[model samples]
Target: MSSTIDESAYVEASNGQACLAFKDEKQEARFELGVSMMVYKWDALSIAVENGWGGPESAEKRDWVTAVIVDLFKSEKIVDVTLIEETLLYAMADEFDTNVEDDSALPIAAGIVEIYKQCDAQDFSTVEKLYLEWTEKQKNKEGKRIVQVEEDPLNPDASESEEEEEDVEFEIEDSMAVDEMTENNTEPVVDEDGFELVQKKGRRRNN
Candidate 1:
């Protein structure tokens, strides 16, 4: 990928940072669109957005992330792979409380660089391809499907016991278990998981 920028906009400063500007505004917009497409293709972000890991506004958060990267490209003279990776990691931690320890951001950054080079050359083929694929995937929801975790099938009784535990825990939180225990004048019993130990219904405890 060509790392060259507009020579007219490049200026040496005491801080040694160049103020790079796009050769053409239309090309810059196209490059930004490509960046957005590549951001959507990132699997780590896809999982987070699909699972609502960033809260109810997960989709909006994803868009914000895209905007931030595009802005970084615009403002900085040199946007390298490391810088892009750092931006993605920081965004995930800040927006979704997710720490992406894996170095999956590298390829995404590389792809962005390639897109930048292509867009600079006035070749919109890559961006057009990404947009069409993205549109089709959106229509089918193909790559965004999440598989729900299911419990072990053989242990029917175990599943029931777990459900009972969950129900008890839910009820305790919903009805203020601690306050009720104090009012009833009963000792609070807790389990290994720090949850209040309530007896499972329809099951007898060993005395």
Candidate 2:
């Protein structure tokens, strides 16, 4: 569902917070903090799930979730950090499938606040480390998938030949790469004003 911030939404500078009035797809008026909008919790959760957060170890899951939270906040265009701790508390509870009462949310909120404080202090190692770890995990997962595909039973015999063909195709495509070529390095060529030019060896040369 789509939600748009109302024109009347205003920010409170003292607390670095904004109370946004939003109308959802159903045209129902609801309020959320600017941090919630910045986090885009729904989208972040989907991305985390797709990246195998649910299958990782508890510590790994927590790290990935926190990284995503921080990344969301960093990616947003909003100036102030608002409702970040609250949003993260809710997101973590949802990720862990736990019931987080208002009282229980305090600790989670405190942790997020600490991270935010660290960020404001210009020390971003916490977020950076977690993001790099998560990225490595994704790369490893992709590598494993590729290996599995190459080892598939039905294609076992053809795998080697298929790989060779792929290598050849890759080489040909690489040779055709034009991004590094300058106009002066290539021969002068002209396009037909009203006629199609014959393509030979995947190259258009003047007839």
Candidate 3:
């Protein structure tokens, strides 16, 4: 969309200090405001109060909530909050005074969904969307992305490597060495009869 500023509506201030309103009409501020329209119809703090974990403390919580949302979409190139929160179209409660009801118990989760519905494309980008999705998953226990395990190849059991061949060769050599040791081991035994104990029984009698 083009800016609503008329080309002739801007002029230098006295002594060229700054630009002055070329037209003395009330058109400039409105034009500027029109150029940059309100992305969301409702106030952010109100949304935070209704949907955010903190309710009456929303004034304090707004900055943090906006920060979380900013972080969520900061990484994205574009975000479609309408698409994300389309399911919760009817969940948006009317924008009420922050001081009205302390414990109104706005279906906090559903309220969050509705607040998300109010988000516009400019408010958040794709990166922020993914981050918010990640955060929500973390909070809801379903936020984590599933790390898909790579499937093994169909021929996984087939050995086509030189390492396997070398392993087989080593196994055969070890078997041969064990077999040779078993075959060649002939333990010798000395018989008691062959090397008899000395018989000096009658020697003392003879002496």
Write one digit per residue (lDDT tens) for candidate 1, span 71-189.
Answer: 67658876776777788888888887899987777677777777777776788788778867866665664333444545546766676768555344111111122334576697755
- The Cα RMSD in angstroms, rounded to one decimal, for candidate 1 relative to the true structure is 19.2
User: Cα deviation in Å at residue 6, candidate 3?
Assistant: 27
Better of 2 and 3 by TM-score: 2
Query: What lDDT tens digits, residue by residue, belong to model 2 across residues 93-174?
Result: 6665544444433333333444444444445454445435544544554321111122345554666777565444111111
- Count clashing residue pairs per candidate: 0, 0, 8
lDDT per residue for candidate 3 within 19-124, as digits (tens), equals 3221322232222121112212223333433343243333333323323333333333333333223212222222223332332222222233222322322232
Highest-lDDT candidate? 1
Task: Give the residue spans of candidate 2 off by over 4 A.
Answer: 1-56, 79-82, 114-207
Give the TM-score (vs. native) of candidate 2.
0.28
For model 2, state the Cα shift of residue 159 in Å: 53
The per-model lDDT (C-alpha) reads 0.63, 0.35, 0.28
lDDT, ranked from best to worst: 1, 2, 3
